[model samples]
Target: MTVGSTPPKTLYQALFNKRMLICICTGFSSGLPLYLLIQFIPAWLRSFDVDLSTIGLINLVLFPYTWKFIWSPLVDRFVPPFLGRRRGWMLITQLGLLLAIASLALYDPTTNLTKIIWTVAIIAFLSATQDIVIDAARREILPDDELGAGNGFYAQAYRIASFVPGSLGLILVGFYPWSVAHLSIAAFMLVGIVTTLLMSESSKPSEVPHTLKSAVIDPFKEFFDRDGWQSAVWILLFIIFYKLGDSMATALETPFFLDMGFSTVEVGTVAKISKTIGATVGTILGGVVMIKLGINKSLWIFGVFQIVSILGYVALSIVGYNYLMLAVASGFEYFGVGLGSVALIAFMAKSTSRLFTATQFALLSSLAAVPRTFISAGTGYIIEAVGYTQFFLICFACAIPGMLMLFKIAPWNSQKTAVEETIAE
Candidate 1:
């Protein structure tokens, strides 16, 4: 086949590719620490008879994720004596996560609520740090064309890692002591630790920032310089708004399900399982289509599904209490969002300059998280004002602005130009 008309790899070759294996490792390692913080820690607290409000308040510990960009520059600047810059920080953060997670088991949340908060907060910080490095590594290692497929595998493996803390770890609670369960979870960090030792550092030593100030200042400076003021602003705004509506729509999900008269078990079991399956399928399909259609077109297509999926929640809100309907709605939402996320991540990866990969990627990814971190707080009030059906309808409307912005930031025909530029480089 001609270079431009090369046939796609067979499924076996695609799945067994070396870089794909590294992507899986990166996803699992990056996911485990965060899941331990969100899923396992909350379950651990509830098991100790902690009140719902206290548990909710404790979730504020996840604030580090929103602010991780501040420290991410340091990740771009320094390297440890041994491993290269990316792997060095990855090793440290992964080790810290391992210790911080296990340390949680040492505290009893009922009696040591303050202590538990401190420990889990450390876990969050370490987890966020790990994310910065892992993301940079993924960006650096994958070629321009592979970003979508690489991130698709990353997303799928991330979901699988969630099962460790969300499902298996919780199941272990029934059969084992909390300490043992926490220790077992800690042991899983070894998956990352070993992966770090085995895999070659994705970034080169020469790419390390020459000075710390440049690390902080130049990532921002270079972004604006390359894209210019107007385009840079558009990119930032697009990142913030692209996922906003879906983020808002799902913020009050558990409560919404409960209010619709579905039991917690249905939400916990059926919704979660079906969503996982749908997400896996959607991510894989998105990766394949992205390879064929390229990032710009994939963004337009995946984005439409994202907006359409919000209406599923509206349908579920009206249908009420049907387990089958819940599964269908939740599943489609997950699938659609998964597709959008793969394209979005690939776009962000492509946008970054390799020298500032960690800091720029962190800033962009952090901006994408704003709606989830801040706007989600107001979702309950919005739902209170206009019941579930109308709230989701509002979300469907909110998604439009981002889709419109795609023409400005990632125009449909731009993908071909982007590929041509990559070829020139």
Candidate 2:
């Protein structure tokens, strides 16, 4: 099979498989709590007349995401006391997230800012932990041939989960008290709990590291050993910079819309319709195209859309207060993001060795999140200093380094593995 050739599988055969269904569950289970923290909480705080600087500093509470790799070895080292390795941790974290999210409503963000910060931090921690197990499970269960399509479905499911909080939760806030809205959002974690109970565990005791030292040290050693240290470094840098610009640009998106003089109803309605539909279509299209385009070409094609999407933000900043412009810009942004995410996720899945699936995926994903967690903390100051228009232009420029790295990491004509080469026929 050539890199540009399509596989012989029918569309029905591609979409209707056991592994793909698992990908959907993984995506939904992993995305919900994250959307709550990143989307719902910021809007909730901003609605209470919180200053932009304080709201920006509140992002610091999400630092757990960037450091999740530190504790991932423990997950790899020890199985849960109850369920098997992956399922056990999935159940534990899902339950913890439910309790944490429900409890968030008890403290008023206005009067209990400190409590809110601490509580939300715990939610972020649990959410990050859940992501590690889910990502590992997805990697283990999916066949190599299904990586691109499976990850595309996974990204789509993740985006769909966001509609629950980003759309429904936001709408509820306008009518009900914030507490009611929060509990409503928390109830949705039931989906993840049900999924955990129903799905089979992916990891067996023999497959993972038996000792803590082996769990902690072997994944790192194996990664650096597979290729020369130089190539490994380039791969790590590519992961870090690829999503950096996009993450920072959208870090304060909900707040940015509100600041642009859009009403909550307007933002919520627009996001519900535009982002949901656009991202869904883009994700499916990205996945299907990836079957023929291969990950390398998909990255190049999607990178163009990703760069163009940043300009949508720049357009929104210029147009100011027009809902029509808001809809167009946000819709394009979501579509581009969804396509780019499919490619990046497939690449990550391809990169990991099965023996170190949990640890290595966690490490890579955690590095990818650094811009969102740490660098994004300063976004409020940047917007305050340079204003929205200039901030977006700066983000567009920042995206170039990652695209440049693609020349070395995933060249346009490169067929990375025999699996990809065969699948392309």
Lowest lDDT 10-mer window, candidate 2? 416-425
Error of 1 at 286 (Å): 0.8
Query: In lDDT terms, how accurate is model 1?
Result: 0.79
lDDT of each: 0.79, 0.84
Candidate 2: what lDDT? 0.84
Candidate 2 global TM-score:
0.93
Name model 2 segments beyond 4 Å from true. Answer: 1-14, 417-425
Q: In candidate 1, where is summed lDDT lowest over 10 consecutive residues? A: 415-424
Considering every candidate listed, which one attains the maximal lDDT? 2
> For all the candidates, what are their Cα RMSDs to the real structure?
4.0, 4.0
